[model samples]
Target: MGYKNLKVSIIGIGRVGLPLALFLENLGCKVVGIDKDSEILRDVRKKKMSFDEPGCAALLKKTKMTISPSIQSGVRGSDYIIITVGTPLYNHIESDLSYIKSVCTDLCGSLKGGQTIILRSTVAPGTTSYLKNFVEDNTSLKIGKNFGLAFCPERLAENQAIEELGLLPQIIGTEDNFSKNMTNKLFNLFGVELLFTNYLSAELIKLFNNVHRFTDFAVANQFSVIAEKYNQNIYEIINMANKNYPRGHIPSPGLTAGTCLRKDFGLLNESSSAPDLFLSAWKINEHMPFHLVNSAKKYTKIRGKTIAVLGYGFKKNSDDIRDSLVPKLLRYIEREVPKKVLLCEPNIPKKNIEGFKNTDLNSCLKKADIIFIAINHDAFNKETILGKIKKNAWCVDLWNVLGQKQLVLRYN
Candidate 1:
């Protein structure tokens, strides 16, 4: 069937699911967006989007797709069911499949014989097979012969989700030709390239992609540390290194935030039985927050000091704090530093942090003895507040907002 004629239903209308539904609808497909939360459905109906993804709100308004709170109602009678639910980690960095299982079970009960199920959530290498087994065991329905299954992991940036969805090439995987064709047919409508492979290859592709990023960020962080000891410009050094022929891809230094980098590395390490070199890179990136805290303490006394955190979200131009590095820094400050910590996250709600005063950016900057730029928000580039900061105060540039100042101690 052509993409325009395929009726698609998206489950878990959170970050990735919401945009996917809207993107499919924009392609002239009949799309139904579903989420467990009634409030999220209500928000979508009212054209209220939660994230900073580009073109998402406008797409939601333009598509006018059917939004439903019931998961079963969304999946029934749909040609394709795309799952974009969260796969968060629990204690010891173990993968939690509770949400995935719940959604699969609900779908299996009502799924028709010819429908296809696509898992867009990132999982371990064997997760697709495991889910297939679970679905067959519970519902007594054959997988492949009865219903199709595939994995098409998301590869979009946090802030550029909608644009990336329609622009970036997608990686799809399935066991049979029919399933692969169905997956490719739907994705092709978005005008993005589709690379087809087996299930395991696609799963490893997602993991390896994140691992490469983890290694890059670790190298950048290590270079920054070395440059700080030698009193050199790390950014300049990185630029110079990139000038070499055929051996240049210097990554920028900053706290690697977002849900994928930190958690995917943990998944890779846990899945590996042998000694993996990539795990060390993952450890380096994971320990970055503590490293910044120690560096902050070495330059200035954090005890009894008023520290102002400039940004709380993981990265700039986005307001998602799922696995943000700022909270880790805050916890370390509270444990070691005997001072009051004032947070200045303009995008996130005040209730996210406990016992900390969420003040305006200007107020926090003026009252703070130490300013930590957790995320480089655009509003901070204004010259008035930047000039007003006390010269004696230490500035921890975690995101490299300030280039090179006498009082600035750049962690990235």
Candidate 2:
């Protein structure tokens, strides 16, 4: 089917689904976004976007797509259905397939004979096959004969969803050639590169990508610990190490916080049958949060002192705080210290965090006895709060936000 004739329905209008719907709609497809939350549906209908992604709101408004709070109403007459629901882990770190199963069961009840079902959620290597079996058994429909199934993993950054969606090469796979070609044709509408493989390989490719990133960041975090032991600067050491001709690709050290990075590593480790180095990478990255808290405490006397936090988001220029390391650090300090804590997040509301005093960038720098630079926001970096802090105040730079100074404890 052509892009203009494709009627697509996206389930779960969160970070991934909402942007994907907008991108598909921009490519001339008739798209409908489905979410259980009425507030999210209302915001989309009123042209209000929750995240700070580029080119999202304009596309949503320009396409004039339908956003419905009911999933059944959204997917009733759609030719193509894409499931982007979350796959969180349970208490034992096992992959929770409850959401994915629910979507599949619902779609089976409303199964169209020639419709295509695509899974955009991340899962284990054998998850796609399991889903296919579940659908075939529950719906009494023949797989690869009556309906098509495929798995197409999403690999976009948080703040750069729209730009990366059009730029990054898409990886897709299916159980049959018809499903493969159908999914590829749908994705090629965006005018980007495409890589077609088997379903299991596509699932493993997503996991491998995140595991590689976790390994690199774990190495950098370990180096930061070594630097603290020798009273040396990690940023300078990393810069010098990257000067080599062939092996000069040293990554910077910082708090590795995000939903995909942390959860994907845990999934890979849980699903692994043999021992591997990825497990070590997972442990190191998981401990980096507490390591940062301990390192900050060693440099500052936080007892009975006001602690000022510079940023609360996971990364720069984004408002997503999932798996953010700052909360762990704040909670640790609050348990150990006997003083008031002042959080200074410009993007997040002050009411979300209890006992947090809301202050502007200037006042936080002037009054804080110990300042922690958790995230490297653009506004916080340009103001140069290092020189403005009190003479006796201690500064903790987790992402190397401050330059080489006498009062700052540079973690990376």
Candidate 3:
């Protein structure tokens, strides 16, 4: 059957699920968006997105999608059920499948024959196979013969989900041709080509995709630390080296905190046969926050110091706080028991700093003795911050985002 004639139900409308539902709805497919969190569902029901994702809120207003809190009810009679739930880490390492298992429990009761279930969450390599086993064990229906199952792990960047969903090459892995054809038609409507593979291979693709990105960031961050030891600028060296060289361009060093990079690095170490390189990279990236804290100690005394963290979000131009490293810095600062901690994120409202004093730019500049640029938000760039900051205050630029100045310490 053609995809336009399909009805799709998306579970867990946090980041990926919300946009996926809207995109499918935009393609003239009847869509149902389900989540266990009623609060999130209420927000999405009113076209309110909690995070900053491009084109989500705008398209949400125009889409004809059913937003529900019950997975069993929402997924009924749908041709496809797409799972986009969280697979957060346990003990900061292993996959916590409680969320996915609960979702399976809710979905297995309402699942019908000839319907396809898509696993879009990033999981350990054997998770899709686990899902296949879980469904068959719980329900009377067989997986491939009576029903269909496929794994199409999400690969979109946080802010660019809408565009990347339509542009990036999709990987759909299944055990049989029935599941493959059904999954292919689902993505074909989005104008994205599907690269077919087995279940474990598709899972590894996402696992390695993110883990390697973490390793790449780790390499640059290690170099940045080395440069700082010599009291030199790593950004200048990185820029001159990559001016026109196209063989292998390295990413800039910053707090490598996001939902995927660190979480998937842990997953990769657990899943990979040879995990020496992955473990080493993980150690470098994991120690970055402490490294910044130690560097901050050099310029100013942490005890009884007023430190201002510029942005709370991990990525630039995006307000997603999932696995953000600002809190890690804050945790370290809290250990020192500083006089005051000021948070200034213009993107986030003054009232929403979460019990901390939400001060304006001018206030943060005036009160803070040391300022740390945790995220290179355009709101707090050198263009906007240079004249505002007090000359006596020390600024730590983790991303080399500041101009040359005595007080402005461009942290490697």
The local distance difference test score of each candidate is: 0.79, 0.79, 0.84
The reply for model 2, stretches above 4 Å from the true place, is: 273-276, 349-351, 354-358, 405-407, 410-412
Per-residue alpha-carbon lDDT of model 2 for 1-412, expressed as tens digits?
5557799999998999999999888888889899887888888988888766788878867667888776677887887899899987786657888998888777778787777889899886788898899888888677678788888999898878999999999998787876876787788788899998888899989989987887998898888878878988888888788876487776777777777887887677786677678777767776766776677677766688877887777778678887777787788778767477778777765555445666777787777787877777876773567567777777777677666522255321
Cα lDDT of candidate 1 equals 0.79
Better of 2 and 3 by TM-score: 3
Question: What is the TM-score (0 to 1) of candidate 3?
Answer: 0.94
Highest-scoring model, lDDT: 3
Q: Give each model a TM-score.
A: 0.92, 0.94, 0.94
Cα misplacement distance, residue 143 of candidate 1 (Å): 3.4
Best by TM-score: 3
RMSD of each: 2.7, 2.4, 2.3
Better of 2 and 3 by lDDT: 3
Model 3 residue 23 distance off true place after TM-score fit, in angstroms: 0.6
Task: Tell me the deviation in Å of residue 344 in model 1.
Answer: 1.5
Better of 1 and 3 by TM-score: 3
